[model samples]
Target: MALTIGIIGLPQSGKTTLFNSLTKAGAPIGGYATSTVQANLAVVQVPDTRVDALADIFQPQKKTYTTVEFVDVAGMGQASQAAKEKREGLSPEFLGHIRNADALAIVLRTFANDNVTHVYNTIDPNRDLDSLNAELAMTDLATVEKRIERTKKAAKSGDKKYVQEMEFLQRLQETLNELGLASDVEISAQDRVVTDELFLLTLKPRMYVLNTSEDMLGEANEVLAKIEKGEQVVPESLKGELKGIAQVALRARAEGAQVAAVSAKLEAELTELPEEEANEYLEALGLPQLGAERVIQVGYRLLNLITFLTAGEDEVRAWTVTRGAKAPEAAGKIHTDIEKGFIRAEVTHFNDFIECGSFAAATKKGVQRLEGRDYEIKDGDIAHFRFNKGK
Candidate 1:
């Protein structure tokens, strides 16, 4: 399945605004259904400096980069009676998009705009967060209920597998009923095969985005701090962007989620400029890259994916495969024929090959070695496949 992250928020909370900025596409952004009937889909390139360095060295005929897909969905909470306890669970159509995503980004408006209407008419991040979370939890709970019913009937066949499966699903259902994610519960290998298809929406990893105004970009945290302290955080007016990078780094150990802050408006403006101009603007803002790149990178991690490189004078390409992909499977990514006729692979770590200056040099220096089909591919591997192509 394509890697996706569904974007949903309250009306005029900048869902499409952020989407258009990330993709540089003119997806509609407004308050009415006439403007956004279908979720806008776009695949943004995953930025990696290693890919660029490989291209510089090989000067190949073709270069390729990995990508992440984003689906911008319409606002939820359409009914007065349907929303439970004043929280707008996702709309059915929007939930369809969210159910498939590997991760999620919740865009909470911390910015002020008299021109744009907040569905709640207040800048309350906690309120927005609670509404979104409740919706996601409800979606997952519905999935678990269906699964429990099916598994319960199947257990009547006197099969031990069904018993084990049902037990696991019951625990999962209970945890999700408590409004927790799939990751919140641990699953054994045996249990995983059973619940794999539930496709529970809240089971997805999530991050928080605090959209602020220009002037308050630096002070966004102080406000978040105040909110975390349970102090009043209602904003009359403030300045920042469509993004606030979460207050944690990519590698920080976490049980549930990550947080980021960014000015989506600023990133959108930068997207309209040339690379040189964008770089200058980013420098002025004291940022590393567009918030979209960070989102893509972090979202990629939610899937436990890594990139392996292949470089030659003929072609320099980056390949996306799971971290534990074996040699034959990695070769299969290039061509099925190679996978079918796999023999051995000439493998050299990219950094070693680069340091030694050439493949032959690396092999001679003992940095390159031959690996069999059982060998698992590692990130930054420079591989040459040895297969029976004539067959």
Candidate 2:
């Protein structure tokens, strides 16, 4: 499957800069707030050290890593009450791109650049989040209202199905009306069939990207570390410097979303340098890795995904599947024929393989196991499917 994450935010939020840093596509920046007619897209390989290690050991003909596609669309916001009332917050073109994305990477600017203007004339990430939420909720509200109208007309047939659907749509309509996310509303299995078609923006998993200034990068990293450590309370001393970041982080935690802090300007510049030089620069800044990398990593996790490996002299590859995927379903990720003709899977953990040095060694050490159709695939599992293709 090709995973896609939509990059969206208010105007001048450095969303394009962050996109360039993530993809190294060098997309042009500094345009008007809504100037992007078409989304800038790029498929970026998900970096994994395990794939490199397996490649080194097997010396495969080719190494293939799983990838995530990023779509950077125009900034979305018409925050006024009038726009919400008219249901005209998001343009149709923008909706077409974002609605299909598996997840969302919402860029929130905390960077203070005098030359580049902010859409709201001030930087308040929490307020910006509220505005974005309102826009999305309003959009979803329109969708629900239309569905309710149809369901109401359909219910006149005195069918129980339409009445049930009408009730669910009414609940969704009420939730979206109050600016609550559709995701927060309880959805049953039956409701999923209805919600799936609506593609409610508020229901997509999201990661909040705090675009910080270069000078505040260290402070931003420190704050993020604290948040990751479960220190929910922002310290008084560092609060002023990272107020927006801290606020966003807390909100992300409350909503079970992901949060990343990145100096997009610095990271984009680093992308222009040699790899070794870039590493040295990051070390000089006391940063362990690029912020753009963290954003990508978190976005992948937001989709509830896991990576399983396939190793051989012919190819050392990484494949993605949803967490808790059964062996047969994972085999299907390789090929539908494999799933149809499924028998069993020879699986070994990457760590165990490394400890044993090779598949033969792992099997000899009794670390390799044969998994059946009921087996759940785990991250970093080196798998070889045993199937009768002739079947």
Candidate 3:
């Protein structure tokens, strides 16, 4: 499955800079005012050491890694007074790109820069989040209200299904009216089937990226650590500069969302250096890894996705599938014909394969097993599907 994440934020939030760092695409970054509605897009290969190891073992003709498509969209929080008056929070062009995204990476500025001015003239991530959420809620409210009108007419036929839908739409309307996220509304599986068509912005799974200064990276990580440990209060000296970061972290935890910190300017500059040199520079800074890598890894997990592997002399490849995906579904990621004709899967955990040195050895040790169509695909699983091509 191909997954796309839309990178969105208020103007001057360093979203483009982060995108450049993540993809190394070298896209131009603009200032506070943007003149173009066009979005920057790139496909980033998901970094997995297992793929590299498999490649080394198999000496494959080609090595393929799973990928994530990122769309860097500008002009999210730019609704004018007239647009707000009409209950429209974003331009149709912006929504066109965002609506198709599988998930969202919301950039929140925490860095202070003297050269670039903030859209609001102050650095407050909490307030910025509120502004963004309110706009999303407004847009969703418009969507729900439209659904209610149609469902109301449909309910007149006395069908229980329409009545149920009407009830759900009204509840969504109420929630969106109060500036609450559609994600927060209590929704059943049946209701989810109905709401899936709305493409409500607030309903998407999101991660908050705190764009911090180079000097603030250590402090930001420390604060996030405390927050993760369920610390309710941070040090007094750290509060003034990191209050917004702490607040956003708390909210993300409460909502079961992911949060990451990155020094955008620092990372962007690092992209200009060679990989080895950049790693050395990061080591000198006492940082473990690139912030861009963390964002990609976390964003991958945020979508509840996992990777499975296929190995051979022809190719050693990584494939993506949703967590709990069945064996046949995972086969479909390779080829539709395989899914249609799937008989059974020979599966071995990655670690077992590594320890045994090869598939034949793993099978001899009973570490490899045959799985049926109902078997769930696990991360780091190596799979070979048996199927009748004539099917």
Best by lDDT: 3
Clashes of each: 23, 0, 0
Clashing pairs in 3: none
In what order do the candidates fall by TM-score, top score first?
Answer: 2, 3, 1
How does model 1 fare in lDDT?
0.72
Q: For model 1, what is the error of residue 283's alpha carbon versus the real structure, in angstroms, after optimal superposition?
A: 0.8
**Over 4 Å off, model 2:** 32-36, 78-82, 235-237
lDDT value, residue 283 of candidate 2? 92
Q: Write the per-residue lDDT of candidate 3 for residues 127-219, one digit (tens) a residue.
A: 999989998899889888878888899999999999999998999998989889999999999899887899999999999999998987878
lDDT of each: 0.72, 0.88, 0.88
Worst 10 residues of 1 by lDDT: 244-253
lDDT of 2: 0.88
Candidate 1 deviant stretches above 4 angstroms? 32-37, 83-92, 216-254
Query: Which prediction has more favorable lDDT, 2 or 3?
Result: 3
For residues 8-49, what per-residue lDDT tens digits would candidate 1 score against the true structure?
677777777888878888787675552235778998777878
Candidate 3 residue 336 Cα shift, in angstroms, is: 2.0
Superposed by TM-score, candidate 1 places the C-alpha of residue 103 at a distance from the truth, in angstroms, of: 2.2
Q: Per-residue alpha-carbon lDDT of model 2 for 16-58, expressed as tens digits?
A: 9999999999888854444235889999998899999999999
